[model samples]
Target: MMLAELVTTADRVGATSSRLDKTDALAELLARADPSELPALMGLLLASPRQGRLGVGWRGLTALDITHADDPLLSVGDVDAVLDVLAATSGSGSAAARTGILVDLAARATASEWDFLVRAMLGELRTGALSGVLLDAIARASDRPAAVVRRAAMLSGDLGETARIALTGTAEDLESVGLQVGRPVLPMLAATAATTTAALEITGEASVEYKLDGARIQVHRQGDDVGVYTRSLADITHRVPELVEVVRALPVNDVILDGETLSLDEDGGPRPFQETMSRFGAEVSRDLVLRPWFFDVLHVDGRDLLDEPLSVRLAELERVAGDWRMPGLVTADPEAAERLSRDALAAGHEGVVVKAIDAPYAAGRRGKSWVKVKPVLTFDLVVLGAEWGSGRRRGWLSNLHLGARDPEGEFGDPGGFVMVGKTFKGLTDELLKWQTEHFPEHESHRTASTVFLRPEIVVEIAIDGVQRSPRYPGGLALRFARVKGYRDDKSPGEADTIQALRALLRG
Candidate 1:
């Protein structure tokens, strides 16, 4: 098994959008991969190593050195030389090293090498493949059931665990089988419906609470010790010591709670989502104006509430959280819930999440048990730039540069706006066409098809909230902001004022 073969399969997978072709190509590649390299291969296939969230990376040269450095069997200079070759060939260290290492090992290498290397390195080998697909492939290759292989891969966080499980029938042979303190488990998610008609059918009631625009967090506490994790399962305990302290102060001992961590203003209202995100660091002061609002409990005193109905869990949650819980909690009442939802929106919060009282907790599942609704506020904003879209949106404007009014002359010249982040949603065919025509007029720079536009056109945008941002020159960013329409009626001066933004921030 050589790396060249893996690269070839990856090239085929990347070029075609057909799932069947991709799977077949992947199967062929997996067949040729050495048993030891299967984990890395699986990671490459799933775009896991490229995700960067899991701490596994493929930044060409730096990644190549780090990967080889972990191998006790390989020499330092050997890894460095491989990285050097990779840098020369691809200019991206790890991708080049990956190709160089494979080509150097195999005497017969050809034009296919370039194709394979490019696809694998770019991490664009999408073939309509799911994690389940790769699991089955590994099972078939190693002579194991897909379930056994899936569990091994998940428990060990490595595909080699699948091969090991297949070769050795014992489950104990798998590494990191038990739940570890720092390890991340996929957090449970809820399915949502858009309209009240759908909500009534799903829960038989319109019962809902306002859904604040904040980060979802899971807190695990054991007596005095506590840990907090994001929805992505990243351990952010060190970044949020205030949350740890708060969880530790809970009345009950040994508990697992699910909640949202938000930044609040001095008046105790929820701050912008961006502000909460900016506070995620070790150096963030303890006095930082942020708070954690616990919503549900999954485990308490070593007891798992996963099998219990929502009603039962809510009782436990209320008992444990008490005053620390989120503001609104309703039972089977629909009308009252709707009022609360409206009040949340009027107060400048996002929409609400409605959960069924009797629904059991389903971990890592998005079913019709829970729903989220947010009030959309639309304002005319200027476009600053566009990033090239990928996959289905490839070649079109993926994200747009958004800006708000600056009457105070604080951001730029009087009446001038600043660059916020970009968004891909809420664009109509007409708007896209208009942008394509007018964007070039304001083009300050161009990289490929992506053009940086001058802030001129006033495009209407609907947003969830406004939050403080370090990236934007205006010192603010929009939450879940998307295009609504082009505000042909209003000029740039008629756009929402900075005072309104400040009031929303206060709210």
Candidate 2:
């Protein structure tokens, strides 16, 4: 297929607001795609290259000198071949090598094709379609159930390859895809609940496992060979040799264990999250020792247990993981759930995940099958600024710049506020309209992307916790901050103090 065809379809997809419309457009395009080129085409449609990060980011792309072509002539094969060359280039001379390849492609591609390619490479294509929508489109094009395709894609962790198989192969072929010991399947996610009572009401009898504020690790093992992957599926097997040793000692020969790992202090309590994140990011000799706590077992000794219920999976996990298992209990009562939550907190854990006892693992997506209960701290924070939204939220002032009051000027000017973090979560269209209409009245300054507001609007913000940060003046930032509501009753003076937030850090 011509690259322009995909580029034009992406433009159309971006222009539409309806998900069904996006799915329909993608399905139409996929229906016309050649079987031989389906994998590459699927990758482009998803705005991520099959090549994976090609060594050139937005900086490298912006530095190149380009001669834009007037005509569209690049084919799927042509672009994929160029990506191959770009991916092959490495070492000290790789930058210039990548620039040369991109310049040549730019010279041969039309303006629209160049735009699409740039967006795809930078991971900024606002095509209004990604895994979920594109998965539906693949299902629609192949005349298969979306569930079947979703399962295959989630199991494989490669949507492009999953689409290729679903479109080109039969029902039996799609069914043949299952849990592999080495490849990382998407980790099952949990939804948030307001209270333990609400979570228990939703899940009935459940296993309320202690939720750790640490890095997520999915361990895949076959005999002695083990690979540890992050939540995003980046293999970090070599980064933690101690962790590999722990997994290697597990009784089962072939296993995939889903768990969390955190560096522990001398008291055996978890260190501050930044310490763990720093260790997760760096591949170096470690100061703090990271302890692994297994919560779920997706596979054991060549037996795939992903489709098994939580009760069954827990039994399998107990048989293999032993004492390394995450601490939890089985109960339907909310008070017991609350007591377990308190026990977790008392034991120096963040919170607890309340999971449905009968629920099977749903990978790569958030669903109501599992609910996480945590103490939510809310504060009346001053609105510092906001940036323009995108796609469905386009034209609205979204992603608010939040601030905590610094009345004593510990970190800044007296009576001023400190910029903590930004959030666009829990916003409705009504709230978006209100912000667009209301924030302009208090606008102190403006930028290409942000409308800086005078510190007058007191908005209530909810957050899981605070993290030590160097980015903001307060030396602290809100973790998982979200909008609760605008606090019309509060003043800037009454807003939450930086000292108060920093205190949360000490706790």
Candidate 1 residue lDDT tens string, 1-507: 454455556556546555455556666666665555555556555544422322112232122321221212322223234434443444346444554564452223334443333333443333434455566666665555656566555533445446545544454454324333334444555544444444646775433656776778888888788888876556778888888888888888888888888887877778766567666654656565568888778778867676688778888988999877876765556666667777887776777778777777665555678866555655567776887667766656657877776644466444456666578787766656667766665566888858886554667677777798788786667888887656433345445555455545643
- For each candidate in the order shown, give its overall lDDT on alpha carbons: 0.61, 0.83
Clashes of each: 10, 0
TM-score of 2: 0.76
Measured with C-alpha atoms, the lDDT of residue 289 in candidate 2 is 74
- Estimate TM-scores for all models: 0.60, 0.76
- 1-507: candidate 2 lDDT, tens digit per residue: 899999989888877766788889999998888877887887777666888659886556766677788888899879988998898899898888888899999889987898799877755565657577889999999999899999999999988778888989999999899999999997897776667888888888999889886778999999899999987677888888889999999888999999999998888888865577666667675877788999999988878887799999999999899999999999998888899899888878768899999999888766787987778766669999999999999899999999987645565454468999889998889899999988886676899999998777888888988899898878888989998777543446557778767866854
Worst 10 residues of 1 by lDDT: 61-70
